[model samples]
Target: MYWWSAVGDYYWSYYRDACERSLLYLDVLRRRGEDYREQSAKAAPHVLSFDFVVLVDGRMLPRPVNYGLLRIIPPPEVETDPGKRPFIVFDPRAGHGPGIGGMKHDSEIGVALGAGHPCYFVGFLPQPVAGQTIEDVCRAEAYFVRFVADRHREADGKPALIGNCQAGWQILMMAAMEPELAGPILVAGTPLSYWAGVRGIYPMRYLGGLLGGGWLTWLMGDIGNGIFDGAWLISNFESNNPANTLWKKPYNVYANVDTEAKRFLDFEKWWGNPILLDAGEMRFIVDELFIGNRLAAAKIATHDGERIDLRKVKSPIIVFCSFGDDITPPQQALDWILDLYEDVDAIVANGQTIIYSLHQNIGHLGIFVSARVATKEHAEFVFNIDLVDVMPSGLYEIILTRADGAEANPQLISGDYIAKLEPRTLDDIRALGGNDAADERRFETAARVSEINRELYRAFLQPWVKALVDPAMAEFLRQLHPNRVMFRVFSDSNPLMAPVAKAAETIRGDRHPVEAVNPFLALEKMASTSIVVNLEIFAKAREAVTEAIFLDVYGSPLLQAVVGVGSSQPRAARASRGDIDLEAAHAQALADMTRGGFIEAGMRALLYVLASGGADERQFNALEALRNAVPEAARPPLSKIREIIRRQAELLRADETKAVAAIAEILPEDSGRRAEILSAIYRVVSGDGEPDAGEMEKFREISRLFLGKASPAELHDRQEA
Candidate 1:
């Protein structure tokens, strides 16, 4: 009787606790559903933790759009300098609301504000105006940038633009269109060379191919009465990882239902708020980007016939991606360099400073919103953005190592990490791996097939779909979409879920919490894990089958011949500009060799010491620290300083020894002025860690040039005088 009673008691306890947990889980989900409904009702709502004021409303532009530019109001504790370059963040409009860049205290906006730069955000409303085109959006963004630039005329450079995901490519386009107006640009979690990806990884690249070239995209637009719902795109993202969407995420909340509610609701507020786009806009994106893959090759032209070229953008570019991001892998994020330039030499010739940083592990959203990334990568970028602007044209990798006992100038380091820009070659980017020639041929054929299918749908099927869908029918269909329906059913709008809230409240009042080591809870987690594994297996298998079909169908010789995109067909390469003449560039640099003085000599000598490879924030930080050595008013304007640095670095690249010898000529004849300059140069040079053999040798030779004729002093006066 004792043994039987003990077994009965265990069963009773398990049954009672499970019921309570179920009620609480339903309560949490109901709260999430309600939060989603409330957020969806707002217009142009952002999750920005900081306050902001609207500056330019794109809806009011001549070619109106749903976009708007807002100036971020920094908190009282943060001081912004008007003379510093302003930072404008463009959040991705890919099926979600704006403010991902400033969604938290530690984010891209926070990084810029902490560095004393003013911040602006370009966000959009939930619905696009009728007949709004992509060109209208682009044109409006360009105007916003110009307005920001014009207002900050006292600043040293053009506004630095930060584009996240979908906005990254748009930023690149605007930068190319008006190269003179953009400053340093950082594109995070963005994929530009859409056709470029490794097999078995980032299967999202094959989505257009699987759908047979976006015929369904046009069909959806037609069925929606000429408007496309962003919910479809959101569904695509969720489907990419079935394990996460189907089991892991929901189960985590169910298991920790009490503690996880707030975080889940906060994220869903942004994710659940879907936007609407014009059908024509959706068709354009599908054709020019998803299927056609023409942006990197400069094959995409504006309505007025101006080709969109990536090479025309003159500002420095920093690409931050991750190996763990399944959506926008490093291969997709960095392949545009391979698509645009033949080699690193071509990159340097074009006078582009391209820097990329790779994280070992981070998801797509984490790249923009994770506090760890904000404190590390974003902080380093803001801290060294000016150095990037003045850096010579070349490819580089940004490396951040922890600041610890072995650091040479730990005192000079601003944060916990020491950041450095190590020079990289095109081979380094290629090492990441991507599609080969055979894969390109297959993709080309697929593009051709897409064009054929798109035309077929337009000529045959579209009219029927458009005719069948009236305004009321379209609205009903949109409301019934799976993504929207899930929220509606669990929200207060549903009477069935109403009793769940009352039961949850009663359970909380008489809470009987289970032990952490409950057998039922353990079994529940095991089942959840098994379900997640099975779902992932299913997703991968589906991807594999889709990929196989795509390759076989498009790779056939007869199909290729019929499509006129066969192996014999020429692939699109970078458009030839032949604009960067290095010899002429060297000659131009030589003309300015005799034009500068003490400050120029110090910078040139520092560049030579750094010529062997590259320097980090050490030298820049050293200069800032020694700024008090001279009067603030006496410092040369930022523009003049950039010009001097560019010329000096160019001369050194063309003729190193000649450039070093000419440093003496640029220096003043006063022995005291020469010593003052030499002292300043050495102080900056020693800022970095102990020099290697080659660097030390160059430093010594440059020191010889500086002390050619010297006496004593402190920080020298500005050279422009």
Candidate 2:
């Protein structure tokens, strides 16, 4: 009797859920259609939660483009500090409309504003101004940066740049080209070394080769009447995970229609609104960057033939990537270092401080949008950015750990986690691994084939395609695309979907949700999981086949010759950026041995010894706290502090013994000031935990250098007692 009752209940719940879900799904589709209608009427649509005033309209620039620089208006409670460096956030325009960087209040812009920094945003309109090239866009962005900088002349430093996805590479190129214009830059999920990826993984890289390269890109632009619809790019993203795009997303909403609708609608507002790009812009992106992979190689040049070199960027760079980001893998994000510099020595020689943080598993979009990431990694970067800006030149990995509120100085760290940076070498980057020589040759062949195919298309098919497709036809075809059609057809504009809203309202007025423990609900979950697994398996298998075909076809020796990838020809290589003189640096450091007063000596001593205590957040907090304690006039500029730290680090690197002993010469002559410096060092180091043996040894040695008569041991022991 009980078994019969259970089965009856399951059947009843299943039937009711199916009916309610069908009605709700239709309503969602109706709402989505209305949203499309509403969004289409706007002049410049953005999903940014904050209001902004346009500072510079790219359309009005000498070389007009559709991009704009906006000054974000902070909320009433958020008082911005004009004295602090301004923050600028640029969202990716890979496909969808702009404003992703500030889409939410707890996002990149939000975090910067919350921290009292004046924030700005770089966004764009739906349609590009005619003949608007990528170069014009870059120039406009550069002007915007300069405009922001000029406004904040009283601020201590230049504005910090935060670039997401597509914007990452764009800003990187800008900074490299005009290095002086940009300050410290943070690029999240941005691809720099386009060709750098592990074989079998990152199948997206093989798309250009498999599709015969930039020819299709050209064809798309031509078909669009001199413009390219970004919908095509978004379709590629959706195709990457069919299960999620096709089934999982919709099913989740169906399962919990009550709460998921708002969230789904908000996301689709940005995702559904695909922007437009000029044919020239698309071609440049595909031929020069996507296929040519010339940015990291330093082969890209301005109209005046000035080279865009990554080494020229003098500001600190912080890269945030994730292992789970299949689209922009860590290899793509970080391998640019390897391509530009042969070793960590080369990076340091260029006077670059490149710090990267790797999250275990946040998807590509999650890097910019995930609330958890916004609270943790992004928060840390925002709060402790001063530490990064003035960090000594070297390669380092940024790591975050949960703050248990049990540390020596829990109050010091503002966020919930503590961020620490540890030194890394070239070998550390190499440990991620990449394609072998043979694989590289295959990619070279692909690039050559792409060039040939593009020329073939331009000569034979371009004129006819242009003749046939006018602006009206292009717009018609764009609306007919699978991505857009779904939004348009299911909308209230459709006569069939007209009754959905009314029906949905009636159902919702008397809806009864099924219990969680319902047998049918459990079955639904299992079925969803099974579908996801199958879809993943299919994606992997398909990717494997794609990889195999690309390897087999491109690796053919006959094709290699025809494509001009022969052994004797050789690939064009950029000049070595690692031309550095270690001996000269060491000598320079030695020459400047006794240059500064108490500030230099104190900063040097603390930096030299902090590593032993694990230079964590607390030490930095303590240092910042100390710096703040000093009157504004008395405090040395961060630039001056950074110069002293770099010189001292170089001296210590060249000769640790001599550098340690020279503290006596660099220290202020007054005995009272010497004691105060020692006290400050102890306070900074001891912020996190008890001093380790290595740290205490350095402390005692420094104590001896400061006070010769007091035995190092006696002083330390007495302080401990």
Candidate 3:
């Protein structure tokens, strides 16, 4: 009888817990549905944490667009100075509404505000403007950037541009078109080379080929009444990880309904709010950028017949990508360098400074959305923007080192950091792409096939689809889309879920969570794991088969010939006419070596020493302090300082020994300034625990060239004492 009673109690508890969980899950879904409805009511819904005023509305432009420039008003707690450079952030319009870049306190806007910069955001409406095209959008964005620059004439320099995901490419287009208007630009999770990826790792690049190219996209747009719903794009992202989309996400909410509801609901608000793209815009994106992979090759031409060449972008570019971002893998992010330039020297010759940082394990959205990433990587990028601007033209890898002994926490840690801008090369980028020419050829074939399929569909099928579709039917179909259907079904309006709210409240009042050691809990865990494993297995199998078919079909020489793969050797490199004459430029720089005063010579030598790759935060601080110590009348502007540094770096690159000797010859043999420079160098190098042999050698060389015969160690020790 005791054993029977025990079994009864177990069953009762299990039934009660299950009912409670079910009610809570329904409540969560109800909240998500409400958020979705509320978001849908707004014309331009976004998740920005700060209030903003419209600076320039693209709706007012001659060729109107949905975009607008917003001046972000910081909260009272955050102070801003007009003297600081303004920041303009452009959020991606890929499938989702704007403001993911500024959705949280630790975000792109937050970091800029924290750094005391006046911030601006470029956001768009959910519906495209009537007759809007990608070219119109690009023009509107360029106008906004120009307005920002004109508004900040008193600031130290031009406004810094931060582009997230799709916006990254958009910003690049603007910068390439009007290079002089852009300042330092940061592009996070942006893919420039769509056809570049490693086999068995990046499967999304193969989807277009396997699906018979861009015809399906054209068909979908035609059926949607010339408006392509972004839900399809969002669904593609979800399909990339079925376990997360189909089971783990839902199960996570069900298992921890108490704590995870708010977070889940917030994310779902953005995920559920799908935007619409014009049919023309969608077709161009799918064909030219995705299927054709023409952007990296500079085959895309604007409406005005101007080619969009990335090398024409005069601003310093910072590319932030992650290894775990399957959507925009490192190859796609970095391989464009290989496509555009022959080597690092070519990049330097073009006078473009490109710096890239690769995160080890953040997903695509996390690159822009994760609070931890915003606080750390975003913060570092913000802090080092000035450094990047002053850096000489070349390829660099931005390395961040945590403060000594800080615990490894994913959340933001407010502290000092040591950043190293180490020089890299085209080979570094090629290594990421695995340097496979055959794969590129296959992608080229896919592009040709896509063009043919797109034309064929437009001629044979698109007209019929357009004729059958009307606005009413399109709206009905959109509402019933799988992405939207689930939300409606679980909503409170559904009579089936009517009892959930009251039952959830009762459960909340009398909660009884099962212990971790419970046999039933263990069984639940096993079931969840099994479901995830099975879904992952299925996803992998599908991807493998898709990749195989893509390769087999597109890799055939017959298909290649039919698609004109051997035609005219890919597009000519769209070399910018503004490309510098490196030899003449180097000669001019060498001549300028004798032009600056004691302060300029000292600063140049100090920069040369730091370039050896061992300088730390302490050193940078000391150098800044030294620069500040100069009288305002004598001190150079930040722009002038950057130019001086650039000239010196170019001279050093041309002839290091002569450049170092010239520094010693140009400066007056006044020991005071020399001692001050040496002291600052020593402080900078010692900040990273202590200078190593390489650093010591660089320092010694600087001392011999600038300060006659004094050992760097002696000078350092003397200064310390």
Candidate 4:
């Protein structure tokens, strides 16, 4: 039956079409690659014109790394003073070469420039200098930041550093190491706590465990004959989404082969130009980051012996990660919070502020590259960065929503880029990490085994491996590598390419376009997504089973001891012991909270009436009435008023029922009014101490009672009245 079905009319036609399309895809890719090389060659002179500086090695390389800056708008260009803010866009140094950030005007850089902020980009060399380390890269980034900051300090606002993927963590490390260099750092799709993620679901994190260690990274560097090819890393990232990697990406090009040639070639030009990393650098990342998982743990040290403690960074950290990003899942992006601080109070006590916004479904690169993301998420972040700065030091989950009223677009837009700030507890974040300590301990033990294996492999096999490898073989191997296939096939050396390039030029001039939202195509994409999800689930289950067996066998105490368990020093030992010094920060926050004089006081009075009516209903109601009667500018200070509310809440906590009865006695109101007042008091007191689920629920219930339900007719009537 299966054999007959395979030969049947529908099956035969579908399989035949797929095969023919695949062949066509290969042909187009070849032509596109050829065209891309020619275009790049034509554009080479323009690229090299910018001033280039090389740090770390203190020497310039064969190719110049160039960048461009766009300044924020002028005062005449806008009605306002053009509140000058500096914007820095750091391009991710993944396998792909440079220019993803500023490839188009409708990019991260473009959005910042259009918003009337000065923009600068940090691009990289085609090849890293020999013996350069990540620490050196970080220092270079810090120097760039300092230069930007100096330029903007004479202006008004501070620079907002936007780091994409690899640059994200690098920028954060720079901030931590040199705390004064940058401000309002935004890490889009950057993973800080590399090991923090849900088990089974995030299988990418399992790669090290499955492979037994960082040996593969070592082996790859060895095979490359001392230079690790970044193409392999890019390949791993692409492989995670097999539908995109194996089918969708190539299939889309073939379906619209004639039209998609430019866009495909443009992306491939950047994607195909893989960078090289020193063997030492690759080993450091594999051991300290991917497997050792020591950055968040605060165990990572610089070559000079300076520890990179993420917590030491005093600036506000705004983490932007999405559900669709498999490479840097929200778990990896966010779990660092849990690793560093015991709770929200610890964050507050340390005088550090962190805010994170999670996107529903945007992929890793899309977080930084997508035009919609640049407009919506990136735009709002830039406009409201100061508001984030003023927020108290603690963890917050930024709730983004459309501002429906006139207050929207007070500065940047005609429409509201409205955002609500909601406080989140440590427990809320830890919920993302579904595993327990036992699970983490298993990995910790695995790290020990990894170190032992790596050490032994180096001692026994490295000598033999090094002797066998020659510079000629290494060059040949690199040229034949899968990622280099396009470059080799489409180079000027390829005999079949000259005619196709001319043909492509003619085809480019005569272009056809289609809407991205085509119904049939979207349906096909959706179906493909479902199949991908199912495959991912199957893959995860298979991995879990395999890991479980491996752990059961190798996780024994005897095996662990032989493999050198507890050999490495505890990660905590590296941390500098000191009490959290929030004295200066607290004073600053208090002063800011107290500003605005009487108007702030009135706002706080209003908050008190809103919060403590049940306990001190008469006093708060009278205060609110007095506040309403007074001139807006003459209202009492908000800071003092909040303090009063805290005092009242504390009193109510001492005796809830009696406090309500006393307030009722003081207030000259009807029984119904007293009940309403009591309910408001209960709500306020409930929410006063610490933010929690139960408190929020109680507050919501009471808010409804005091605010009351409004009918459409009633609202209109009030408006008319």
Candidate 5:
């Protein structure tokens, strides 16, 4: 009976492993329940690694806001350089609590700290300050920036602002209002143009239209007694990916019970800690931003009667969006540029430098959370902050090339790589991708309908709902929400889960894990896959129905007329001011070309040539090194240097030949200085690799103007090099 004994051993191993896994899974749940209980007892809990003390509390403001600024104290291992530019990171307050930007070592704050920069975080309390408006929050953020700048007065520049998702728009608003307070601003996975998305491809944009718009939000807020439960927003996020929410997430933890528990629990801690918003604040965000699309159009006004115009922001803006991010697609992030400017010329004319980088396939959360992205994209952004700040006013596409010649894999980058900021045009953006006007019209109609519905609800339904509900009932509803119920049911407080801990302890002592080749384990995987597939099918069907209903209802000619959809085309472009005297500006640039000495002229020519071919991190680092090589007495202030570069770039753009020739006219006729300048230019251009034809030609032109034609020996040396 040897064959019978083998079969019996196989069955016993499989059965024992399965039972142990079940117990361990229950233990995971028990721990999760305990963690939830502990978290619930705290006010404004987060997962930040570093210690911090509050610098500015928004609650103490004249018009109180929930936001606060915390100065992160870098650990002993992480050195801080006070002379380096400081960084201020603002996490998204969409639905969850803060600290996503600094939750782990391979995160935004971590990268900044690694680079020896002082890091600060903008966090908020669990509850909003009563009657706090969006404008008040913006003011508080401005105050925070001013305080940070004051604290870092000895630093090279103002603090670089990093805004994640919802904080992106908030940061923009603050920058627009007080441009002097910001340095280079980086917005990750932020949607500035809410109505922008490719039809049929991204269906989340249609949800507001499908739900009859902002009235439902208003009703929910009223039911909550002037506080909107953030659980609803989190639920909406979960609904977008049902298979992940309902099957894959749970199955992943269950299938890898031993390893996945901590990860699942860590993420759930943030996911479960939903924050609240004032009713007015929620209404404004829904109506003005998502519905009216006012932010991009510069229609959003502050209490002091100043229109919040993004163009007013003097700092360079860096937008990081992903193609796979359904929540804030590339169109939503980049379309605001098209909305704000008529063309690339307008963007330059406004003296604004905008840089955008697109990740190929990172999801919404991955843009900010993925360790791979943190170490690569976010690190590059931080390292290149000064480069972006000094860049000439223009549109640029931040290109990250692979260091090892494979592909531009972010995970492969580990601080040693090449990053390029290539000049781009509005046409490049249009070619990249965006939604059409027809899609926008439907959203506009939804906005109008929402206004009508909001008025009707306030006039009728809201009063009755408010009179019926009290704070206790509202609290009960929040506690009974499906999102909360799931955590509560799996908690250790439940009598059914009492035996789980003891059973898990016993299983842990006698643990047995089945091999991957096991027949039962294979079956389990197949079952899990089938469950995910079925749930995905249902999700797709539901999305189809939702989109169909939205289109049919909002697309109706009768309803369109009622909402005044066709009254006039949406004001996509601002009226031409006809105020900028282009000829006068050109003349002024020409006159200013001869205003500097050899150092300035040489630097200008170098920048012009680099601009012609585009610049990457290598070129930037070489230039910085050259600048540092200059004698202290002769060195110009960095601000003055940037000003010179800006004026030189403008002149080159206006007339390249005149601008290049003017550099020779401006510099002294000293062959030694000229040779030194040419050598520096060669070094900068050839840092990454061989210079391209355009770069070579630009260099040759500069040389002809400054150092005459190269001799045969020089030409051969250049070719050989």
Candidate 6:
């Protein structure tokens, strides 16, 4: 009986091993069947470009849009004339493919085409075209813009360029290099100042430092036999959301596998086909951008030693980034404006127009890919690029909010698009990048440590590793990568479970789907949520420990002293185009200032109140009422208010010499009246903190030209005589 039991156990073990081998064999057959099916589908006439490319390039050669190796989808059957303003949509070459702009008809390109603008796409090949540097891509994109511009110049509006994500910075580089070739430039979710961010947030900027420097990129490129897989970058992005990466994303697809097949396939096709960057290119990005933070510092130099000054671009810049984007946070996107100029006035003074829009909560991918964002934000931006072009040269926040029915100045477009305006201040923008010196010092120290580690790694490990790697092995490894394997081996045909595939297809076709909003579905979602929560907890704990260790070692005051913080100030004032003459601006500014007499009078009134006693609400209300009821003639023009302030400053300048006599002259017959007048004048004159250079210059000139060499009392005495 004991011998019989032992034989049975052996038989069970053999049966299990045979079953696993059989399953593997069946998977290979099913994958071949799917490949055959895909090839058959490609040959079918119904599928456009065999479910590959949708747009046809109508150039002289009449090439396929897929010649660029990007899948381009054309708009619906709408007759858009080629004579209209052409729209060129450039997808940011981040870790993803090009279709984020036109994944659907409600995209940036689609919205432009819907508005009668002829649309074109600027995309890249899946593999780099041999020696294709970023400079070559910029040139190609510029040539594309030139083509569109020439096509639509007769229509009066220059072709508009919409750049998404990493494409935003690329477009700016193109625009800066060839300012005359393009029109409006819209940069969405691109970081110009790579190192700009506040503490407790935007910690992604610290990643290169914590992991060492660009040498890791070099190591990866070496392992890949001179090609750095973009999947690594995509993995870094996924690591930011561990719950989604580990469980939530896969579970959701599995739960709705029947309905999610097409969507999952389409997205996976793009996300899975990760591109490669050259070792040198990746090094430039990590060294010049990620660690050096040189772009905003005016320190990014070309191979020829020429500097790429962002201020040189003549076209208006529209910066669109969001708070929720960890990759390209609002700080990295907008702080470059602050870092490149002294103030909002300096931006205008440089003859450069920059407008930025900040969304409350949209992640990096959502900035250009999310359908809801495309409908609302991208729609408004397209409708108003012309308005934005005409806006006064200064920094502005582009706000998009719902308009009430009765609002008079609503700008309406096709189907539920309503947009309006609200002014924003520099203070509002400072919330993102306004970190103290100590925080910046910490990051600086991290950069130093990273440099040291990177050098050490290259000296010790790289030589031995490179000797063991080759191109064929790299390619094989890439194919075997988990992301690639999913596409290569999956779906319908297995001898062991051939029935399951047939069942799934039938279930998809004959779908008795429950309502998406069902209560039981919500319970299923709750169970999934628990799994996600636990994953998130583990990820957070890991991140916290990593950050703590990093900070403990590299965040010391001694390290900060050794590796200094980069200045967030502009190196020097950018040379202006002299479009706005300084004298003319001064006159205009004076004119605007003089028009606010009541504001001047209120300041005077404030001086009296503060000097006498702090005013109660009732007293303030009474003063406001009286101020509102004043006659129009009494209210000064901007010129008069400035003139009054000018004369008062002049009086103060003469205070050392003619203080008593001048005081006697402007003083009223009553001592109380004289005190009141002097106090009011002092408040207005000293509003911007004593006298500045321009104020002093203006005062000297005004005194010589207007009042001659006489005091107020002398002039009064002369009039009396």
Off by over 4 Å in 3: 1-4, 405-416, 433-435, 567-578, 610-617, 669-707, 717-721
Model 1 CA lDDT for position 306: 84
Error of 2 at 658 (Å): 4.2
Candidate 4 lDDT over residue span 599-698, tens digit each: 3322332233443122222223333444455585664433334344443333343344443333323342354443434333433332222224553454
Task: Say which prediction, candidate 4 or candidate 5, comes out ahead on lDDT.
Answer: 5
Candidate 5 deviant stretches above 4 angstroms = 1-12, 405-414, 567-571, 575-583, 611-613, 632-634, 669-671, 708-721
Candidate models: Cα lDDT each: 0.83, 0.85, 0.82, 0.62, 0.84, 0.58
Candidate 4 or 2, higher TM-score: 2
| Model 6 segments more than 4 A misplaced | 1-76, 81-83, 409-418, 421-423, 452-465, 489-500, 506-524, 561-721
* Superposed Cα deviation of residue 26, candidate 2 (Å): 1.2
Instruction: Point out the worst 10-residue segment of candidate 1 by lDDT.
Output: 711-720
What tens-digit string does per-residue lDDT give for candidate 1 at 1-721?
6977866766667678778878898888788788888888776677899999999999889999999999999999999999899999999989888888998879999989999999999999888899988777888899999999989998977799999999998889888878888889999998888888888777888878878998988999998898899999899899888889988888887777777877887888888878888888898888888788888778887789888888888889999999999888998899989988989878877878899999999999899989999999998888788777777778999999888857776777877788888999999999999988778888888888888998999999988998899979988998988989998888889988979888899988997766676666677778888898899899989989878888888788888888886576554666785477878887887776666778778888878877755767787777766654678789676567777777677777777777778888878878767665666666676678555677667766765676643322222232212
TM per prediction:
0.95, 0.95, 0.93, 0.72, 0.94, 0.68
Per-residue alpha-carbon lDDT of candidate 3 for residues 1-721, written as tens digits (9 for 90 to 100):
6987876776677666767787888899987877787888897899888899988889999999999999999998999989888999999999998888888888999999999999999999999986788888888999998898899888877889999999999899889888888789999999998987888877999999888899999988878888999999999999999999999999999988888998898888888889999888998899989998788888889987998989989899999999999999999998888778888788877778999999999999999999999889899888766667777788889888776654332122234556777888777877775436567778888888888888899899888888899999988888988978887777776898788778788889998876566666677889999999999999999889888988888878888888777634453354453546877877887787677777667666766666662233445545555567789777666677677766667777777777777777677777877777677667655655466676677788888776666786688686777
Comparing 4 with 6 on lDDT, the higher-scoring candidate is 4
Which residue pairs in candidate 2 collide? none
TM-score of 5: 0.94
Which is better, 4 or 5, measured by TM-score?
5
Write the residue-wise lDDT of candidate 6 on 1-721 in tens digits. 6976766665554444334333433433344446533532441111111113424231212222211322233445656666455667787666555566776666787677666666777665444544445655566666667766665666535777888877888788878778767667899999887767765556677677777667787788778877777777777888888898788766755565544555655555456556666665666677767886766766765566766668767677888888889789888888777666666656655556677878889988788877788888888777665445444355666656564544322222223444433345566678655545555556566666667767786899888778988989888876665655554445453344556455445444554444455444566678898998899788777767666665665666665555654444223233333354656654554443323322433342232223221112222222323333558557443234333433332222223233222323332355444333333332333332343455344333323322333333343343234
The deviation in Å at residue 552 for candidate 6 is: 3.1
Give the Cα error of residue 43 in candidate 1, in Å: 2.7
Estimate the overall C-alpha local distance difference test score of candidate 1: 0.83
RMSD (CA, Å), candidate 2 to true, equals 2.4
TM-score, prediction 6: 0.68
